[model samples]
Target: MAKFFGNLNAVLVGGLAVLIVIMFGLHSAVLGESIYPNQLFRYLHVLCGIMWIGLLYYLNFVQVPTMPSMPDELKPAISGHIAPRVLFWFRWAAAFTVLTGLIVAHLSGYLVEALTFQPGVVLIGIGMWMALIMAFNVWFIIWPAQKKILGIVEASADEKAAAAPRALIASRTNTLLSIPMLYCMVTQNALGV
Candidate 1:
């Protein structure tokens, strides 16, 4: 059990196996029907969204604040190793979240209505547009700036300096948008809007 849990791949596979069982066994029994594509995409969307937003919060609430106080000698550990890994996951999670979310909306037959902000789907449309903007920031603005800030790509000292604020502002914008975005997503179903 220790060995199995110690390996990330093994743990992920185990978790997936459990999900398969629940989906086929419990879910089917409860719903009396197989899972639909929309449901699957919704699940994926929620999963990826968690990773993306969680990382975003971590960067804002923890990493950025802590960095200034961190000792210079120890900074490289975070910048050289940890930050790169975190950014890789962060950017990919952002991409997958958007992809899955769009698929969910499309499968649910609300892609056009939501995008266009039609009457009934106004809440979800707002959420979708916010998410799309955040994802665009993640892929285009933040990631490119981060590449410079993290030394993943070549940049002069002045260039890296310029990148830092660009990345921070974009990330902070996403953080600000996340609050309302999440509210719209959660309340859309509950309010029956």
Candidate 2:
């Protein structure tokens, strides 16, 4: 038990197993019957979106602002050790969030309507577009710039300097877009749009 709890992979699997058990108990023999494929996609979309936005917030609200204040020597610890792993999860989460969201929309029979913003799907469409833009920033703008800024790719001092602000701005743009994106997503479902 101690060994299982100590490992992150094990802990995650154990937690999920517990959740399945609880769900099974609650639903009894009808456990899988009430769960729809779209619901699964929705669950996955929300999970990935949380990871994506949570990391975006951590980068914007915590890491970026705090970096300038850290002593020069200590800065390397975050840049070298923490940022890389966080970025891996961040970018993948963004990708998966978009993928799962699209799957949900398609499964629910609104992919075209949502993308086209057909009268009833305008709000969800807006949220989807924002998410797409945010995902694009994560992959194309932020990740590329971050590679140089973090020295993952060889770069001159001037290049690294240039990359930092690009990454910062793109990240900040996503943060700004996230607010309206979240509102649209939540309200569309809540208000029955």
lDDT of 1 by residue, 49-160 (tens): 9999999999999999999999999999999999999999999999999999999888788889999989889999999999999999998999999899889999999999
Worst 10 residues of 2 by lDDT: 27-36
Scored by CA lDDT, what does every candidate get?
Answer: 0.92, 0.92
Q: What TM-score would you give candidate 2 relative to the actual structure?
A: 0.93
Give the runs in model 1 whose Cα sits over 4 Å from its true position.
28-35
> How close is every model to the real structure, measured as TM-score?
0.94, 0.93
RMSD of each: 1.8, 1.8
Q: 93-164, model 2: which lDDT tens digit per residue?
A: 999999999999998888999999898888999999999999999999999999998899999999999988
lDDT of candidate model 1 versus the reference: 0.92
